[model samples]
Target chain A: MTKRKMFLRMITASLLRRRSRMLIALLSIAVGATILSGLVTIYIDVPRQMGAQFRSYGANMIILPGEEGSLTGAVLEEAMQVIPSENIVGATPYRYVRLDMPSRQQSFTTAGTDFDEVRKTSPYFSVEGEYPQNRREIMVGKEVAETIGVRLGSSIELSYKPLASFEGEASADWVPGAALLGSSEGFNEAVLNVSAVLDEEGKISEIEVDALSQTENIGSLVGTDKAFLDQFLGKSLPLTLGEDVDALSGATISSQAVVDALNSSRSRENARLSENKEHYTVAGILSTGGEEEAYIYMSLEDLTRLTQEEIMDVAELSVSASAEELEGYAANIQEEYPALTARLVKRLAKSEASVLSKLQALVFLVTAVVLALTLICVSTTMMAVVSERRREIGLRKALGASDGSIRHEFLGEGMFLGGLGGLLGGLLGFAFAQMVSVHVFGSSITFQPLLLPITIIVSMAISAVSCQLPIKKAVAIDPAIVLKGE
Target chain B: MALLELKNISKIYGDLKALDNVSIRVEKGEWVAIMGPSGSGKSTMMNIIGCMDKPTMGEVLLSGVDISKETARSLTDIRRDKIGLIFQQFHMVTYLTAVENVMVSQYYHSMPDEEEALEALGRVGLRDRARHLPSQLSGGEQQRVCVARALINHPELILADEPTGNLDETNENIVLGLFRQLHNEGTTLIVVTHDPEVAEAAQRTIVLEHGRVAREVINENFGK
Candidate 1:
């Protein structure tokens, strides 16, 4: 017989000679290995599943202005340093301006945004019509567009009320007679041509007003507007001058100036609107279903004019990598930059945290207990075997077998048993893991290719170590007395 | 030439002295028997001479090499190669068949061959029963297998302890005849026994009293 075959035959025969006792040991080993394989599989998959589950919440990380910070674009860029540029998927800045809508005959809030950044950062915004491209083109929310009867190519006036300047912290009830820079009537106004109308969840600049008088025809409204203009201008003048006399009453001029200033700003932005259609394109439109439909979608320049700020308010950042290396990317960003955090969410995050953590902990604890019990079971079995075979060991030694050879024989038996058990256990463990994964997390578990060799090696090592004392005792048996029965 | 020697050998087991200052010599091709009363140290001397045990004092020499200083490994080498052992109880591995039992000795040798084992069994006239296990064989047949095992390695010294002590007359005669055949083949043999009849069957007989050699006698018709 070949050497390996002979050795294997010897091991099999030896094991067979004591099959009843060894079966218990074998069973224990198998159980231990199964638990080990299953738990390890879950451990490696934890972070990936959790990250993805968290990502489904729509926003992974939000960029709020740092404490004691400005919403200016430059300040936003500085805050970007604290964030890992690689982990950010998108960044958008926002600025709001309060203005009057004559068509609505009421005050409304308005928001100016970089449409490209908004589209990249907000997955929730749903647009119904074509997105706005030119400065003259504005997409209004469904609610405001309907009230103004403004279709595509319709011109609308926008007025902005400047923030009241105060030297120190002021209570909400405190009111300045007139804004230090200018009264509302002295502020800027702009006119925008409607390009598209959005569905809902739109944004609008905030403005205060009495009402807009609707004229049946656009031609008749512009034609008879001189007497109306005289009255409008006459009422708007005294309100700014009389604001110091009474801050809360008869200040229609300051209020009307806010409306005019908003319109003027909108018209000026329209002049600068160049539909390059390349660097500047319609990213998306938000449909707030209110004045956002009357509000306009534009570039950073349009947003600055509407908000009366030098730069955009909100900033968005993002990074991309191969699907396989996404986890590494996340880890690298988190490790390299602790100030910023990246999160992957929704279903992946929720399952990973809520389901996987509990499951893994359970598996780990169970595996540890099973492994310890397996070691004890195998060790006891082997000790009994060594004692029973004391005479056999003596005989072999008397026959010129070295102590090393004797030890090798026993260790070989342990290794063989361990490997056989591990193979069987690994198969069972993989099935068990899959079942638990599907039942608990609603996903099929994949068998890892790496566990095969690792299981066998670990099982063999554990068995060998457990068998150490018994094998040594067997090797050191006194042959002379054993042979003579002394 | 002397193949075995003992000088002032003694063996003590706790409070009992199994052998005390015993000395004996056996020449090559000699068939010798050691006779003693119970506890007279004959068995103890046999154990020492066969290298199974060492004397508490004194030395055992095989072919003039002192064996008292030999390590356990070296002593085992002596048992496997230089000295062949046969027991009265047959001492055959019961799991193996007749031929396999004979081949057990060849395991100690570096080059164990099936052909050599078969030839040795054939010499002992047990080739036909080669496939029969020890349990299947009669007492005499099992002893013959043991003889074949001992001769297969062609050891320089053959130590048989009570080779026929547990056998009937027929089996005893069969085993004694085999020893004669081996002695004719130029192998030195030492047989330890308590019976005078068994001692008389050997060419020379040494008697032990207490732990020392008492007397030596020559048998005129050992083989006859």
Candidate 2:
């Protein structure tokens, strides 16, 4: 037989002769390997699992208007594109405005948002009824509903009156501007300078008019006509000559021309600030114990139609990722859309990171303790075996075996046991990790195939190191004394 | 030239001298016996001669090489190449069978040859018991296996220390007969023993007392 085959045979025989002692060493190694494999698996998978759990709390990121005064739909879309879609749970945009309820003599802060995205970003919002479904429907906060004495299914009228800021000023030169002139038959033909201003209550505070060019008869009544326009001041918008004020008695065409020109100029000043009055049903009552309870919420589509403007003040996002990853995404968003500022909600991000880090540290400590104990136990058992085989070692040395060969035999036995134990422990460790994951997190874990080989290599290294002291003892045997029955 | 020589060898431990100024020599193909009482340094002298140890002072020349000055590693190689040892306890590896026990020596010396190991065992009349463990064999059978193991490497010298001390009368005769056969084949033999019958079987006898050689005697009887 070959020397290698003979060496293998000798060690195998030696190990089998002392099976009971070797079993204890094998068990220790397997247990250590199991804990090492299981804890490493848990350590790698914790962040992803915990990140998903933290998402249920609320949005952890927000995008607000940057240098621009407000955000637009294009900016929101660009921010969403910068963040990976798979990591985004929700992205909701909001716009706020204040409108008056003349019947109650009070104005309420109104918020325009998407209800579909609100379900993901603001899951804590509890509505008494339901979100607004149409332009004629709106949701009122609990504080607003109680103060206004409105319940579900009740109707409330909201009005937006345009300010009477003038488009064309009446200068002393009395030069009429064509762009400010309206399409009335006599109005377009005449050259008239008109100017107006509104008070905080949207009432016409001041009025001025100059008839630059007109018929000789009407031009003669210009001084009298200026005094007639004063009666229209202190009146609300959409004023009519017949309803709001009396017409000039003898110059009816000039009186119609003056009134039409002033109204046309108001329309050109602020297109969105027209006389908007709409009745909407109270669809839902929000009862959040925060600032959200003092406002009215409605769909963005409906708000856009009412105000004739499409914009958002801020966007809230619920993204499932670690704090560092969230920071990277925020950086990307700011780089791509400089007009938007992205920020993380530090309270939620810090708490998630803190809990995840502590858990990983605990697992690492436990694994280290287990491996140390295994090393001590295996070393002790191997020392006992070496003690028992003192005579055999002496005999081998006497038969011309070198110290190097004796050491090789003992180390080979230990490594072989380690390799076998590690393979068994690797399979058992995966199952152990799965059990812990399912029981504690209420979820299953994925298998990591790379851990098996790594576990085996570590196990073999530990076993080889454990054999050092025992092999030293074995090589120190003196054949003359041991064989002499001493 | 002498096949083995130890000139004024002194082995000391602290203040005690185990072997003081011991000198001896054995020619080629000679069967010599060393006889001594307890504490006479018989085992110590055998250990030095077998290359398991080195002397503190003096030269031990085996085939013209001074082994006392050789390093431990060099001594191990020299022992593996030229010396074979037989112990009194028949220290067979308890787990290995008889044939495997013989092959152990062959493995360390060179590549183990099962056929050669079996032939060595057959010469010692253990061919039928080659597969039995040491515990399963009788005292005589185990001793014969040791003999086979010591001869597997075809060493130039055979050093046997009380080889027949643990055997019955019939087993002792069997082992002595094997030694006689090896001696007849021109192999050198050195037997350290307390038995007069074992000493009388050798060609010459050396007696030691108080770590010194007191006398040497040669046998005059013919081979018959």
DockQ, computed on Cα atoms, for candidate 2: 0.55
Cα lDDT tens digits, model 2, A1-486, are: 999999889878877876788888888888888888888887777777787778777789999999865688786887788778998989988887665576874556678899889889888889999988777799999998998999999999875433333344322112222122221223224334445566665566766554433343454263246578778667765558788876777666767766665555533333222446688899999988988888888888777777677888788899989999999999998888787899999899889999998998899899989888888888998999889888888888888889999899899999987886687778778888888888877788888899999888888888998999999999998867644535
Poorest 10 consecutive residues of model 1 chain A by lDDT?
Answer: A190-199
**TM-score of every model versus the real structure:** 0.61, 0.75
Judged by lDDT, which candidate is best? 2
Q: Lowest summed-lDDT stretch of 10 residues in model 2 chain A?
A: A172-181
Q: Can you tell me which runs of candidate 1 are displaced by over 4 Å?
A: A1-9, A45-372, B35-38, B88-104, B124-145, B163-177, B193-200, B205-210, B214-221
In model 2, the runs with Cα more than 4 Å from the true position are: A69-78, A95-310, B125-140, B217-224
Tens digit of lDDT per residue, candidate 1, span A368-450?
Answer: 78787888878888998888777657656655566776888899999988998888777777877777677766667668988
Docking tier of model 2: it is medium
**lDDT (Cα, tens digit) per residue for candidate 2, span B1-224:** 89999999999999888899999999989999999897888888989988889999999999978899998778888888998888888989999999999999999999999999999999999899999999999989999999999888888999999999898999999999999998999889999998888999999999988889989988766265
lDDT of 2: 0.81
Report DockQ per prediction, comma-separated: 0.19, 0.55
- Which ten contiguous residues of candidate 2 chain B have the minimum total lDDT? B215-224
Interface RMSD for candidates 1 onward, in order = 3.3, 1.4
Q: For chain B alone, what TM-score does every candidate structure achieve against the true structure?
A: 0.96, 0.97
